[model samples]
Target: MNAISPVAHPAPSDEIDLIALVQSLWRQRLLIGLVTLLTGVLAAAYAFIVTPEYQVQSVLRPALIKDLDGLNRTGVYKLTPAQAMQRVGAALDSYERRLEFFRANQGLFEALREPGRSLEQTFESFNRDAFKMLQPDPKKTDNLSAFVGIQLTYPADINGVALVNGLVEFALASERERIAADLATLVKNRLHHLDLQIAAARASYDASKEAKIAALLEADSLKRAKLQDELKALRQQLRTRRDNRVAQLDEAIRIAKSLGIGKPTTPSALGEGERASQGSVIRTEVNNQQIPLYFMGSEALEAERNALLQRRSDDFTEPRIAEIAKELQLLAQNRQVEVLNKRENEDLFLKDLATWREEAARLRNLQFEVAGLKLVSVDQVAVDPLKPIKPKRALILALGLVLGGMLGVFIALLRNMARRIPKTANSAY
Candidate 1:
């Protein structure tokens, strides 16, 4: 209890005093108002001073030649009308062609460049600002209908309409030329291949014909030799039989003389009686001997000769040989037919190649006549736009007013908190 006489209590430092805070802010209301007004003025000035951007746009429809009616009558190109239209549409929508066009006219963007800006930077800026878009038209129903639409956007200050039209023309022409050249080259190559094939086919046909002829000749020679050998063997057998018959008859006469049958006594006795008696006795001996004799009759000999001749003829005109000959004939006919077909095909290809050449020449001439190419028709050409597209002054000023009011309130609260903290520190000391 030594110094417990009177203890002084310190105020709570962490408690929020709402009434005091309100009073402090009220005192600094003038400063807050001044800062808010100044911020609003600055925002308004910025909105008015900044340069606004403007845009010019145009709508285009692909003006491609459909059905190739002009060229179709000549039968030069094989593409159908639908195919032709598709090709044109594809060329129009090609990004590569668009890029090529952009690069080609990159120098045209130099006029839009500011001082101290590099050409590359200017080109990049121009590219970012420009736009090209393609879309299918909703109104068209046909598959081959020319209903595609193209829109191009550019800065309002430049002559963007003419530039876009020029680029479209150039791209279309280049694509056409490229397609024609490719087709012509293809036809030429095919024709050359067909020529080579025809030559090879002709050679093959000739070789086959010669081989068949040689085979037929060899077969005929073999048949003739075989027939001759058979005939010679038959002739030799006949000669041997005839010689044996003569020998047998001579033996029979010798035997009759030995037996003293019909013997002649004197030379005068060699008359009719002796001859008759000798012939009768010789006949009797021939009957008694029982010898087998071969008597070749005139008719039989003639028949054998006829049979040999017939066999010789049959050898030459064998059925197998006839069949082979028939086959060879058919083969020759087929080869001839094949060659004829090839010739016909070659003629057709030649005609097709000629047509391709004519078409290519026509396209070349057409390109020369029309200096630049045109892919599309400008539906609505871009005109000079008067209104700027950027910098909404009213919107910016409204946002600035709201933000400035909030910041002023935050500053007033911070100052009040700062003064309160010092007072609390002094009371603690």
Candidate 2:
């Protein structure tokens, strides 16, 4: 083997030299420089010619009015305006419930979906025309309500103020509307009743006066009281008469004894208390003619006593007091029956009157309750925005350019980086 030197070879991609490349670029400097100048100029021209947009921003806070317990307007027990607004907001949110709120917001959907209507119009019409934004949003909201913003864009030499003003009109034009149904309040009612009480009262009033009935009752009571009084007096008179009769009988016996008709000691009349003095308990012995003769005088006195008893029986025979007492008792029973009847009739009337009063009171209370349900306001904000917010064109263009530039550089580098490697060899002689 002859002594031969080995050779190293460079890859095709690496064969490019800095000096040659500079010479080639110098030779094409005019075209290269022109291309760069043209690119920059075109970019400047495009940027300058791009549309300029004016934006309006609206900050919307839900309208909130403070309302107290639906009864007080300005009392201590009232909810704050913010709280009421929150409640309204919640209710508004509940509008999403399709079945329940239709009664309250009737025709609202129709108004919102009106032809040629704007998104803001539909949302703004939630409370119908009762609501209006003092300051509108600058951009279109990406919500179901679709509240919109107004923006104006102008070309390089175009007037921005006019464009923005026109855009604003377009955005604000043709408002969507919904019907307002919150004016009517919720209420519960019960049926009214007053006739029953009135009827009962009238019936009672009719029963209070009756000619025969009054007379019969009065007469019966008077007869009973009079009979009772008379019985009491007769008892006292009878006692006095009995005492006088006893005395008279004793005197008569003395007179009889003087005339030799009976024993002087014999009592012609005697009360139970005076029986011992009158020999009421004495027993006479019998069996001898002489003994009969001796007590003959006592027997005559005893006969006198029997005759007095007969007279006393005749004098006191009529028990008129007993008869009167019986009649009085009958009258009293009749009076009690009448009184019970009267109570039954009067109670019916009283019940009627009570019912009437209760019904009247109930009506009055209902009226009061209705009066108490005063209309209170919830929070509603009035927008007074001085600036417009819309059209983030600058930001959009910047993002677009960055994305385009990254894509351009990545594609250029990918094309230059080849997958295969080159090989070199030296010839043998």
Candidate 3:
């Protein structure tokens, strides 16, 4: 009896259970089919009702001024290709900034909306459907690549392509104006700085000239004073010698009279004769006797007086003074020449500054004209896309069908588990 035992019946295998699960699902096929059909119908309805989005793309190349050789040579400041490219980059950034501004100020996009729509509502709707994409081309070996790809997406109703083009044009125009204004301002500032430098240089030169002239005048004044003092001393000495000679002649005449050699001569007459001699002793007859007392004085005194006269004449005609005067005259002439030269240089500089200013103005006008004509070179303009890029109906329908079938299977499994649970509980009791 022990052996006859439940001759080892193996428990049902996992494969059998899996087969059973398939059978259970087949039994609920109607419910699964209904749910899957409903889901597919709902997906189809959504696909048809939702609006489709269209994309427009354009390719653009920055209009860079490549040949700046002439401009560089003409202007005091030079603009380089790299700098131009930098401006292009800035313009691109400005384009983005303008887009942000458009977002903040919704009224700007009102014209692009449907009739009867408020500006705020239109902006919200447009923002929901519209977007812009800017992609720069990868750098090349030449490093001068300037192509960019732009794309705009919007609902089929609006003119997104034209709007994007207009915005780009506006951005380019603004950028050109900004660059021109900046360049003009820089040129004017440089000219102003040059003017300041010239004024300072002229002022310094004038100060130096005045200082030199003052020094020269002081030296001349000192020399002239010294010579004048010397002349006065010579005149005083000559007067003293003449007086002494007159006194000696008077004394000699008195002595002769006292010795009874001759009649006495009047001192007044002798003094008057001495004065008439003009710096020399004069002989006179006194009571019919010739005194012969005419003193010529030493040759040295005469020579000294003559030398003094010569020196006085030399004071006015001294070679050193003449040389100094000539030097002063030459210095004055040189100063005048220098002043003239400085003025001439200043005038030339002012003329150059004016020319540069005119050039800057002309360049600014040219830039404005160019911007007005064409902002950027479009390699390919955006075209109206024929096909929509959203709401993939086939994929959605397939996913919905699959998901519905899965949900039906889950519900059937849950009900089967609930029934088994009650049965197991009853068995346990």
Local distance difference test, each candidate: 0.57, 0.42, 0.59
Which candidate has the top score in TM-score?
3
Q: In terms of TM-score, which candidate is stronger, 1 or 3?
A: 3
What does the lDDT read for residue 39 in candidate 1?
80
TM-score per model over all chains: 0.50, 0.36, 0.58
RMSD of each: 10.6, 14.2, 10.4
**For residue 370, what is the lDDT in candidate 2?**
24
Cα deviation of 258, candidate 1, in Å? 10
lDDT computed for candidate 1: 0.57
Model 3 residue pairs with clashes: none
Put down candidate 1 lDDT per residue, 221-276, tens digits, no spaces: 66656655555555555555545544554453454345343332322232336333
Candidates ranked by TM-score, best first?
3, 1, 2
Model 2 earns a TM-score of 0.36
